[model samples]
Target: MIARRPEGADMEAKLFGSRLSPFVEKVARALQLKGIAFTLVPPKSPADFKRWNAQTRKMPVVEIDGRRVFDSTLILRRLDQLVPEPPLLDRDAGIAARQRFLEDWSDESLYWYAMALRWSDANAEATTTQVLGSIPAPAALRPVLRVVLRRQLRNQALAQGLARLPLETVVDELGRRFDELLVWLGDRPYFFADRPSVADLALFGQLNVLQSGPTPQAERLVAERPRLADYFLRVDAATAERRAEPGRGAARGVDFGTTARGA
Candidate 1:
C-alpha cells in the first residue's frame, strides 16, 4: 500500500495522479507555482485505484488541508484563491475568457489527439511492455498480463475513435492547432498576458507532454516558440524548489521522477 500523509495535517497537500496525464501535471504545476507543500502518491495497482476512487472518483485528486479537490481546472482556481499574490487567472474578463477557451481546448479537444497517439499499435505495445516490466508480477504471468492490457487499451482506442482515425489526420490537426497558437501568441511571452496565468499553465502542461515525446511537430513548435519552452522550464524548476524545502511546507512538490512511469 502507498503511504499517505495524514490528510489536513498542517500545510501539506497530497496529490494522487498518473504522471502521463496532462491534467494531473496541470494541478502539480499549479501547486509548484504557488509554493504549496504536497506529496505525490502514485497509484500503481488495483488497491491504489480503490483508494483514489474513494476520494475523488478520479485521478489527479488534490488533498489540501484534508479537503479534497477534483478536476484540474478547479484545482488551478483553488490555487489562485489560496495565493492571490501571483494570480493564475487574468483580471480582465475578455482575456480570462480567451485563456479559458484555450485551456478547455487543450483539455477536451487536444486530449483526443494524445489518446490517438498513445493508443497506436506501436505506442500501445511499448507502453504495455514498460508498465508490466515495472511491476512485481510473476515472470510467467507477464505475457498474459500484457495481452490483457493491450486488448483493454485496444477497446479504449476504439471507443475513443483512436483506432478508427488515421494518425496523420490527428497529427495534422494538432500541428494546425499548434501553428494557430503560435500565430496567436505572436511576440508575446505568454498566451494572453505578460504574466503566466492559469491558461498558460494548462496549455503548457499539455504541450510539454508532446514536446517531451516523439512528436516532430510538437518539437518544432517548441523550437519555434522558445519563450514558451523557457516558461515551462521555469515552472518546473520553481516547482522542484518548492517541494525541496524543509518541513511540512517542503513536501509541496510532486516528484515526477517517482511518477515517471505514468508518463
Candidate 2:
C-alpha cells in the first residue's frame, strides 16, 4: 500500500539512491519537473542498503516530512499529491491508465535489457571498474570489490533470464523497442503530449542508462535512432534547466547535508 504524507513536519525531502540507477533517476526527474526541492543521499556502504528501505534494499526511496516512501512509481505518486500544480498524469482515467501501463513495462521489462547490456561480459570489466571507482572506497579494496560485485550483478541478471539470452538477441530486441518508441513519439516532445508525463519519466530512466551508462551497445544502438537520442537530450536539458533556474534555489534542494557519509 502507498504511504500517506503526515502533517506538521518539515517539508524538506531527501532521496536515497545512486545516480546510476534508472529507477532513482525517475524520482529525481519528477522532483525537478514538479519544482519540488529535494536532497540526494547516495549510499556509501553495504549497510546503507537497508537504511532507507529495510524490506527491499532498493532505492529512489524518499524521506519527506519524516516519512519513508520506497519505489519510484509510489514516490512519484506521492510527490504529485504533495505538489499538484503541474500534473504528471492525466486527469482522464483512460490516459492515466495508459501512462501507468507504460511506466510499468519500462520499469519491469525495458530495465532488464539495459541491465543485460551493462553487465554483459563484453562490458562488465570497464563498467564495473568505473562504477566502483567512483565510490568512496580504499583503492586497494576497490579492485577486488569491483570483481566481486560484477559477478554478483551478472549472476543476478542471469538468474532473471535476460543475461542468459545471447547478446545479439538482446540488442535486436532493444532495437525493435526503440523503433516502437520512434513511432509513438513521432513529432511529440513526449510520449503523449508536449510536456513530459509519468510514462516519459519512467521511459527516460532506462534510456538515461543507455545514453550514459558504461555499456557501448546502448550508446551505439541509440545513435542509430536519432529521434530517440534527440528526445532523451530534450528531456535531460529541460529537467536540468529546472534546477538551474534563477530563483529555484537548486543548491539548497540538492544539498548533501550530513547524511551523505553514512550512505
Q: What TM-score do all the candidates reach, one by one?
A: 0.79, 0.87
lDDT of 2 at 6: 24
After superposition on all C-alphas, the RMSD of every candidate to the true structure, in Å, is: 6.2, 6.4
Tell me how many residue pairs clash in candidate 1.
8
For model 2, the stretches where C-alpha displacement exceeds 4 angstroms are 1-11, 241-248, 251-263
Candidate 2 positional error at 165, Å: 1.2
Candidate 1: give the clashing pairs: 8-65, 8-66, 20-262, 20-263, 37-252, 38-251, 38-252, 88-198
TM-score of 1: 0.79
Model 1: how large is the Cα RMSD against the reference? 6.2
lDDT of each residue in 1-263, candidate 2, tens digit only: 96333221224688888766788878877777666667787778656878778898888788875689999999888988887756889877887887888899999999999889888888888778756854677777876788788888888788889888889899999999999878878798887677778899898878876766477787888889889888887877655524344433552334232111111
Candidate 1 lDDT score at position 175:
71
Candidate 2 lDDT score at position 68: 90
